[model samples]
Target: MDHNNMITKFDESKYLISMAPVEKVLEAGYYLNLNDQSNVLDLCCGYGEMLKLWGEAYGINGKGVDICDEFIKKGNERLEQSNLNHKIDLVCQDVKEFKTDEQYDVACLIGEVIFGDVSGTIQALDPFLKEGGKIVIGEPYYKQKDVPQALIEFEGDLLTLEGLYDTFKRSGYYVSYMAGCTDNEWERYISWSARRDLEWLRSHPKDKGFDNKEKWIDTWYKMYFNYRRPYEGWALFILEKI
Candidate 1:
């Protein structure tokens, strides 16, 4: 069914992939006090919207890596249109294998922990961060401990806010700042994503993956609406290496 391709199609034209509100994203950059001299690295940088916004806001230079070719292409187009291609570099590659010799003033893994574990991902990213640099992570936390088993399986070892903080602290990082998504914001994101998928499904009824796409959309909508929306809390955490 080319599930990856279908998902990419569903996400077409969207900017931010995470549950974070656009204002929250801008607030994160402001909280970090990023300047023109700041160099940023964004892993799993979907469509490069956050980096582009930061570049325009703070004049920061950034490098973004994502595995989606369509997203990278769109990001490049946006950069070129904004005359920001020289300021920001967008590459299509799996972040786990993305290598860079230079260190960054800021590194981010927004809503994606491709390294399979949050602590492990942070450890892997540590070498790319310059001294005193900040790392930003956008992740979902369990709102309560007694979530459904299916939801828990979908989320994979999520923790409470306190646990998330302790994880960073134990990993030798300090939590400098955090911004959480409002319930309204989370609902809007999920609803919008599901709507987009439904719209695509309606328009592509004759496509080879039609049945699979429809099933995927229905299942995803049910899972998110019935479980994630009520039990999951999403947040952006800014950490500094201690």
Candidate 2:
């Protein structure tokens, strides 16, 4: 199967697609101060939950860009059924290549889609934000300075919390509101992810990459408990374009 197909399966059971504090997701959405007229651009929006939340709670109009057509189609259908189709649109496309001439009141990059780095992401997304608009980014961070070589590929070489501030300033963004995932939350999310992988493998034991995937399951848990758990974190940060 292609990479996107695997992604669809791996994340099929997930709704919002972030390990960040789930309740805080809505709080960060509220910080956008959206209304019926507000426009949001959600990059890598999974299952369209963010837009759905904003639309239902704050009555915002928005567009979501994701590479998964299955996800986008389901989201669009639900929106149409709820009489929300007029306000929200979900398009299937690689977010990095997504384009639009229109500017939005808020631009969001949530979960697993930072194209290069946070700074590069800000530059790529800056052109789409209105002058006073806010950008909400939710992703992982390296919690410790001593890095594990094995985790780097999956870790994204993330910034420490302090370094993130420097990065925000470097990208000409002003930090507004932020929420960090608790250790309990991280443990819960990681364990849940492992469970999902295990469940997939159990039913598809004969799948082509079973051996490789099985190895990953063992490695992931081993690395998490030993290296990642104490040294990594997820957070949602709202930034203002400076």
- Per-residue lDDT tens digits of candidate 2, residues 1-242? 49996674344325556766445766877777778999999888866877877787789999999998977988888788778898899999998789889999999887564578888778777889988988888767887877887778767577888898899998888888999878766776777778878998999989998898899988888888887887787788899965
**TM-score of model 2 vs. true structure:** 0.86
Worst 10 residues of 2 by lDDT: 8-17
Clashes of 1: 0
Query: Model 2: runs farther than 4 Å from truth?
Result: 1-14, 153-156
CA lDDT of each candidate?
0.85, 0.80
TM-score of each: 0.89, 0.86
Candidate 1 clashes between residue pairs 3 or more apart in a chain or in different chains: none
Candidate of highest lDDT = 1
- Which residue ranges in model 1 land beyond 4 Å of their true spot? 1-13, 199-204
Tell me the tens digit of each residue's lDDT in model 1 across 1-242: 89996674344425777777666777899999988999999999988988988887789999999999988999999888888999999999989899889999999998876787779878977889989988999878998878899997777779888888888988899988898888777877777777878888889889998888888877887888899888889899999965
Q: Give per-residue lDDT, candidate 1, residue 179.
A: 88
**What global local distance difference test value does model 1 have?**
0.85
Tell me how far the alpha carbon of residue 23 in candidate 1 is from the true structure, in angstroms, after superposition: 1.3
